[model samples]
Target: MTRQRVSLRQELPLLVWLVIVWGALWQDFSPGNLLFGALIAVVVARLLYLPPVELGGRFNVLRAIPFALGFLAKVVAASFQVLFLAVVRGPRVISAVVAVPLRSRSDLLVTATGHVISLIPGSVVVEVDRSTSTLYIHGINVRDADDADKLRKEVRETEAGLIRIMGTKAELSALNQEVGA
Candidate 1:
């Protein structure tokens, strides 16, 4: 079997991110330190069996800004909601592992959506069914079918927002058609 050729453009983001993380870890911003970090990053990138991350080739900053703000708001509200549930329901808080079937089959989008949902309080991704592009999320205060439906809807909406921001044109078109229909 032959290895797939990876373009420099595809690898650059990972290398740059590695350098930034190295610098952050070392708490150094000096030019010499950064140069050294860059060296290490390049060496690591070459030595590691890294998988290629497919990019959308276009990013919509305008779409990203609103999504970010909305995510922050959800974080805040979920925090308060979790706090309320903890105080009122305590150990008796109703929780369920709700299955959320996502539209996008892209690993990047599905993972991003799972992360965004898990970052907010009261829910966490318990398992991911990559074969089905599904996320099984354990949610707090999900007492019935309605609550579970809301959780699934919330997770899918997050995926839609991510798709709008940087999804491939095909994915965006499909999403648009789905919404229009």
Candidate 2:
């Protein structure tokens, strides 16, 4: 009983989430649904708390909104560019996978980098080497070395800014130093 009390205190958010879920279910309150929802919520809450990567921090989520918007714009522009290249150049356009170095150390940051690149129209994350912190991206219409380099730069810059906003102080400092070096 004492141990349960202490653990519950440490996981107050989970308790609050349980209460919210119970209240919602209780209103309509089907017995089967209530049991299922409670079971699922308990499992999810336990999983959320067990992760070694601390998700809580004093960070600005609002900053990420602009980053997402900018990324969306870039995706749209790239889509149109790819369409134009496909229609105008046909079989002559070159596509190649280029390896990109990532500065952020967090798994979340790295996953976000891959996801964002994959979301872009003319680009896809073809491979990721987590051990080396590198991403291999396939770029459509990558005319030459210059175009590939430019694409890599743009992806790095965008990911760097997002990482700065989302990452912990230690991570942000390391990432900044890596980018600088």
How many residue pairs clash in all the candidates, one count each? Answer: 0, 0
- Model 1 misplaced stretches (Cα beyond 4 Å): none
Please give, for residues 109-145, the per-residue lDDT of candidate 2 as tens digits.
Answer: 7888888878775688988899888999999888799
Q: Locate the minimum summed-lDDT window of 10 residues in model 1.
A: 49-58
Per-residue lDDT tens digits of candidate 1, residues 68-121? Answer: 998899899988998888789899888999888898888888888889999776
TM-score of each: 0.90, 0.69
Structure candidate 2, residue pairs in collision: none
> Cα deviation in Å at residue 76, candidate 1?
2.0
Instruction: Please list the C-alpha lDDT of all candidates, in the order they appear.
Output: 0.89, 0.75
Candidate of highest lDDT? 1
- What is the TM-score of candidate 2? 0.69
Off by over 4 Å in 2: 1-39, 44-58, 175-181
In model 2, state the lDDT of residue 29: 65
